[model samples]
Target: MSLRSGSFPRTFHASLQLLLTRRFGTFWLASLLSNIGTWAQQVAQPWLMLSLGASPWLLGLDTFALGGPGLLLTLLGGVLADRADRRRLIATLQSIQMLCPLLIVGLLLHGSIQPWIIVALSLVVGVTDALSMPSFQTIVSTLVDRRQLPTGIALNTTQFNLSRILGPSLAGVLMASIGAVGAFAVSAASYLPFIAVALWILPRATVQAVAPAEGGRDGPPLAGARAVLAQPALRGAVLTVLGGSLLCSPLLTFCPVLVKTVFQADVAQFSLTVSAFGAGGLLGGLLLMAVDPARDRRPLASWAASGFAAVVLLSALNPWAWALPLLFVAGGLAMTMANASANAWLQSQAPAAIRGQTVSLFMLAMRGGTALGGLLTGLTVSAWGVREALALNGLLALLALAGVRRGWLAVPRPTLAG
Candidate 1:
């Protein structure tokens, strides 16, 4: 389960060491701040919707708005990432994203915000993210040494999870004190540093040149799907994550509904539950950071997803005062382990020529599945109730686990050229 090489650094601080060795640290810092801002907004945005008396369906629709565009536009985004200057492309898209929260802040301050307006802005941010995320994912490889790639990725996940822990807690306080306007304003400001780093700090050559695609380097956008499908390990990673996102991710997406409706909790308790999940994820990412790069992560991801499913099922059965938050922490850990492993495995196995496109497929699976799952689960919750909806998700995850155990979802031990 651990990387077994004496040549590579085997210490827990391998990822942390990378911070002092190169500019990847710079990008990571900027990205962490931006992500924190985003998470804060996420907390406030949902609470804002509930305050407007929106239904569970609307809550789910909000999540869908935040991720739905990836289903249609992410492939093109991947293509653009490989074909054009990644830095400029990502910065441009991020600029567009920054505007969404800014507009929300304006509406909030003007006292004229509605549920549809918030959802509409989320859709805009989601569209920009779908286009830019492939490039953003691909750019990490360019920021560090290839041998240190796994650690670099782990660090990236760590920062994101860390933000998840911090953002919700911060929002809880901000929402109580200065309200949603303050949270939205902070999200707007966080994007500036990242944009500056992308445009002014990172070298142009690092983000500008990409490996040419096959057949005169002008293959269709769907070419990445073909490339991924051709490899067993790659295919398994994508499918595993797809199933994980589709069945289990909704539990986290709809946590507010679970808290407010089922437990009748207030904002502080809701934020506490979210922070617990983030804490577990932080631990998972840190665990990955210490592992060797050569370890095959396929089985790890599969097992984690299975564990996550079991936790989701347990959440439905437990009505104890302390149970749900603890389960959420476990869910967060398992989910992060599954996702980060699949992501690192895919990035390592995929060829350089189509890395962006391949990553886009990963994004499509992760984000697209979440969007659809949120919508479907929302409707299920409306019809059956939160407990039944979550129980169904857990059962579905176990079914996916059955497929993995039966060799239906295989990941052959192999590596590929970059």
Candidate 2:
């Protein structure tokens, strides 16, 4: 990782070019604002639940409810992305998600926003998000050429990570000043401009379903999954991500539990931990943006998994004073790098025919698997406590990742479609 000798300036220039593209620039700006609002709301959720006296299991269940619908619908979304009008679909989905926050605002103001209500709202957001994300990711291919697609994805990750950088801290400020109601309002307002941008820009990020490998057929969405699994590289990436999600990704789900129970931190102090994690992840995204796609991404991804899992295992040893920094080190840098690398690697390597489905599977590994993991981790936290649950599972996952590290390296890169 010696900075590739002379890669920074080129990467920086490429990223800037992507932002300057008329269609992508509009989408990116809108997405940035919307994502910031989304993250701010996310930061408030667990804290809000904490105030409602949410148990560990209840917290995990809430996350599962939010993510589970996507588990079922995202593959379908991938199908829609390939076969439908992506711009309209995205706009429609965005509009649907936008309502969740606005509706919740009234509930919050009325002091009737219970944990169950939060869970219900999360389901709505998750379903729409599941449907929209595959289309969203594949749109990068259309917005930029093949040469800049990976950079564009990295930039996309940067926007998300940037939300992490700004959203939680903003949530902290709003929560401190105006309470959760204000924080939720900001999130609700974020969607308007994002929808407006899509309606205005109408970017050409959609494509026809052309998976010639399936004999140039137009079958069900499962066909796309089969096509992706047929590739060893893509398969390996998906599996590794599944493990990461099932083991390490649930850290956020339980963050409230950890911060409140172990660290004795309030909402503002808890936001600091989130802010630290975001700062690290933002830096990590920048580093991954500079990674050369010409390199074999598998081996590096394996190394990152090993490192990330190890950190999770160690960080599970909860000494509150140092836990925040530990999380920044582990959750922030290692996990972020691993996640971004996996995404760029997969997107760069996937054939145009199966890109939508391929991206959806990645989404599944992220949201779906993490949802399941979050639930299990919550139950574990309830029974064994956060420290034991995290340590045991983190160790098991680390060992599993260590054993399979070389298998990922063994997966040969498929020939890219020009």
Write candidate 1's Cα lDDT for 1-418 as tens digits.
Answer: 5645753355665567787755777888888899889989988888899998998899999889988999999888887776777778878899999998999999888899999998898899889999999989987877766676777888899999999999999999999998999889989999999998888654564433433344114666567667776777677788888888888989887888888888888888888998899998998888888777777787788898888999989987788746888998898889998899889888887767777877888999899989989989999999999889999999988998668645634446645545
Residues 135-164, candidate 2: write the lDDT tens digits. 877877777776677678778777888888
Task: Note each model's CA RMSD in angstroms.
Answer: 2.3, 2.0
Model 1 root mean square deviation, Cα atoms: 2.3
Name the 10 consecutive residues with the lowest summed lDDT in model 2: 208-217
Task: Predict model 2's lDDT versus the native.
Answer: 0.79
Error of 1 at 5 (Å): 12
Query: How much lDDT does each candidate structure score?
Result: 0.83, 0.79
Give lDDT for model 1.
Answer: 0.83
Winning candidate number (lDDT): 1
Structure candidate 1, residue pairs in collision: none
Q: What lDDT does candidate 1 reach at residue 145? A: 62
